[model samples]
Target: MATFSLLVTANPHSSQGQFSAIQFAKTLISQGHILKRVFFYADGVLVASRLNCPPSDEYNLTKTWAKLAIEHDFELVACVTVAMKRGITNAAEAERNALTGDNLDPAFEISGLGQLTEAMLESDRLVTFG
Candidate 1:
């Protein structure tokens, strides 16, 4: 079984790439592959925002990603640089930056590009969606 890492660079609500990536991850897991990590970059960091709320009838990719990660025991990491620039932050980051509040979801972590490099080095395949 191939060990995989995923890079997502698309906005969750504005693009189809996020959905495609999610489905791809599910399929790979079902095929008995190991998912090492999923890195959210650029606008993809929005998926880690706790403030994201879709309509009751619409699909919530953020929640979906969180649930999937919890079920599969994989990491959901967002780019710290991009996330902060987009106003998404954890408590530590918010305090450090002197922001009024944090909106980053608890299910996601904020980290640097080294995490992405590590994922690429450790996984058998690194797939990008955007």
Candidate 2:
């Protein structure tokens, strides 16, 4: 089976971007293909934020992606630069930066763009869902 890397760069509330990413990742897993990584960049950093509390009726894409990553063992990485700039930092980063609290989920890691580059190099296909 081929391994794929998905790069998501759109905001979490954008229906097109969020649904498309979830569908793509789920389809890849269902097809027996491995997901090497799910790299969140730009506004996509919002997906890693645990503070995101959408309405109960709305689909929480952040939780959906987090669940998928935990279940499938895919590396879910949020771009450190983008995430920090967008105020989506983990406990350690928040502490280091003197931020109030950790706003990012544990399922996703804060990493550099180098991780995305590595995913591109290691995977059979690199698909962007923004």
Top lDDT prediction, candidate number: 1
Pairs of residues clashing in candidate 1: none
* Candidate 2 structure quality by residue, lDDT tens digits, 29-54: 99999998999999888889888899
Give candidate 2's error at residue 75 in angstroms. 1.0
lDDT of 1 by residue, 15-86 (tens): 999999999999999999999999999999999998899999999999999999999999999999999999
* Candidate that scores best on TM-score: 1
What lDDT score is found at residue 120 in candidate 1? 100
The clash count of every prediction, one per candidate, is 0, 0
Ten-residue stretch with the least lDDT total in model 2: 10-19
Per-residue error (Å), model 1, residue 61: 0.5
Model 1 lDDT vs. the true structure?
Answer: 0.95
Where model 2 places Cα greater than 4 Å from the true spot, the runs are none
